[model samples]
Target chain A: MKKVALLTAAIIICAVPFYGQHFITKNGHISFYSDGPLEKIEAHNKQVNSALNIETGDMVFKVLMKSFVFEKALMQEHFNENYVESDKFPNATFKGKVVNMSDITLTKDGTYEADVEGELTIHGISNKIEDKGTFIVSKEGIHGNSKFNILLADYDISIPGAVTGKIAEEIEITVDVKLKKFSK
Target chain B: MKNWIKVFVLAAVVGIGVLIYVWFFIYNKPHMNIEKATPDYIISASECYDHYANGNNNETLNYTGKVLQIYGSPSSIEKTDSLTVVVFTFSTGMFGDEGIRCTMLPSYSNEVSNSILSKEISIKGYCSGYNETDVILEQCSIIKN
Candidate 1:
């Protein structure tokens, strides 16, 4: 009880007051699906950090590259050491804004189609991309989800000839984040 | 006799190659079992948070990508989807927030359920890094009862 109280007090002290305009989630989930000729690979990372500004529709999310847990441990090792190089890059980040911000109504608690555009940095390489998603606001909280595909070659993640058929050229990515209003 | 020997050698070579491939890529390869594995660093959660707050590059270089057994008072215990996350926090920082957050695996759900909240407990997980406020550890498990 005391520790929770103290942590709560600290949160009140240090949190940036975005008020109703800010939403944040520390456990946002991101999963990627790769369909290869030899086999399919899937990995999920739930330790994603995301902050959204409901006022301007600006959003940012980051996931530690090594945080992505794979079903196969060898795949995880290969991913960090060979593909993404998590030791060197550490994280993949997306700093984008909801392009169709004006169309969404946050107070109404309805589904709104949104276009998100910004820089996506993977493996230390940044690329500008635009994608579509949905935003939902309700009395419970705010929810956002987006899906897109990324080519590994675009990020300079090269699959060696030995295992090229075991990996896909374009990996599908899905992002789901639930945010609560930021309070200070 | 020579032809028979050559065929046998080729078969042996192919068998060895397949064995190596299966051993490295397919056999016993999956999510790590952190609960049973030994921790690389045994440090208190508060001390670890202090390093993350004060030490910049050097701190990140040291802790990140390492396995940690962090002990502290549980600030909060919450479940997201099927995963249970035990958070250890300090009331000091720019955000007045710095701590170790451990996400336990599903196999430890029963143990996590029976855990006493607000008590000192130690957990083992991989240190991802300090993300401005909190040091993140994923695929965690209870280490100390």
Candidate 2:
């Protein structure tokens, strides 16, 4: 009887955190854009770094260095081998918190705009960033959409003179994330 | 008469040289565009394993998936043939309660140290589905960081 009680208590302890509202999806969409005179270059990595800790309202995201695919094979290779050196720095990640987790109940149908602040790491560099997005809480999962700007130089990405006009200094990024509440 | 023949020969030689240069340098150059050529079906490491476990064979244009971020050295599969494969393991879900471990077989060209094996990578390839313990992706190209 004592063992049964201990097991029950352990299960409850493990299940308590899951009772909160938090959902995750491995297949999330994260896209970025950089335009230049020669070409309008756009690349995206679906395998982004992502996690949502419901108990703490902390969300994290990651993307592999070598996963950002542009339109050209040579360009992709250069971006990995020469520019990003994916072998050296394998991933880009973001860790932040949802400002208003208690105010919104994600299980029911509702829309809430939350401010998220976190450290965005890319090209082996980490920077503190803040972004705002709309989060729609549904019975199925959580949907989030946000956009932000990043400077190529901020991450030490140097565009050669030959392709200088082809790439922009500042690029716009759009993220459409959908996370499912973790089943306890 | 001799001078005119020599002049004609010289002109012909230059023309042939120019033609050769155009053929080799202009036309025979690499036409593959890396940015455009990368397979877009970017899938997460765990999802890649799931597809392999289920034995799903579908070649899509691109995949949008997540990168597995676990701290550990990567392990390479002993090569049965000329092609050697590597494996990485991840939990069933990104952030789940129960940690159901799954393995991912990434077909890579270059080799890294065991210590640096967990180098996160996003690979785009033609999914040929599962092969025994490994998932097969053909003609994969590495995306930029």
Candidate 3:
């Protein structure tokens, strides 16, 4: 009985850090910029949901298509109605993992380069992506940031020939999120 | 020949005017004024969270992209240098507490004081959609009764 009790206590001690291994942020920020020949378009979505499991190097991000705010209401409308079809595909998601998770310690305070590979889905289509990101570990939280460019055609986001000059073929996406330790 | 020239000149002038109107008014229209917009749904925060938590896809669909006026006491109010976020927590999930997270407009940031904690208040914003854990609202403005 004493041996069983000792094993149970050891299990509890091992599981304590595991419980705090997950990090999450509901109010993450994601923005995309399009530099076209005729026009420059940019939109920002502040209410991004991102979760990261430091133990397993798993990460996921969910962004609402309708949450993207453009400076021009007409462009925003066109984006929802024509470009991305927000009604049909209301969310863009990424399910990926940090390839080099073993190099960084979460308890340590420093910025570490993160190599991420994942499936990014937009407009009901998914594509494999490999990119570099940074994880800044601070006393407050972990700040995750990445900048990458994605071709609209890769995700089946087609632009009409008439307004092709007003929208770029490749869009620059920036992700900035400060994640806090997730405790149940 | 003179009549044709006159007609062509008038058509060109009209075309230019149309292009100007399209460029200044239609193409560059201002964003939605959330302060003046009416709420499509008036609901409590808990009720809103329950709809998503129960996997009521149809019910959740009805609220997405629509303006909602939610009334509830915030579980936590996070004020930062950039924006203020008011969170209405429902239950603990795999990531964290799942609920409605309302990001107030920058102009209304000053109005969300710590004194309003646990006090019922109404906030109106555009419902972006559920991110599995929480229903996000942006361009939020506090509604004073």
The true-versus-predicted C-alpha distance at residue B111 of model 1, in Å, is 4.0
Q: Highest TM-score among the candidates is held by which one?
A: 3
Looking at model 1, residue A144 earns an lDDT score of 88
The DockQ value obtained for model 1 is 0.31
Higher-TM-score candidate among 2 and 3?
3
Tell me candidate 1's fraction of native contacts, as a decimal between 0 and 1: 0.33
Q: How should the candidates be ordered by TM-score, best one leading? A: 3, 1, 2
Using DockQ as the measure, which candidate wins? 3
**Residue A42 displacement in candidate 1 (angstroms):** 1.4
Residue A25 in model 3: shift from native, Å? 1.5
Give the deviation of candidate 2 from the true structure as CA RMSD.
Answer: 12.9
lDDT of 1: 0.81
Stretches > 4 Å off in candidate 3? A1-20, B1-13
lDDT of each: 0.81, 0.59, 0.88
Can you list each candidate's DockQ?
0.31, 0.10, 0.61
- What fraction of correct interface contacts does each candidate retain? 0.33, 0.13, 0.69
Task: Judge candidate 2 against the unseen true structure and give its global Cα lDDT, from 0 to 1.
Answer: 0.59
- How many residue pairs in model 3 have overlapping backbones? 0
lDDT of 3 by residue, B1-145 (tens): 6999999999999999999999888987677787799999999999998987798889988998889999999888877657798889888776577789898999888888888789999999988788777888888999999
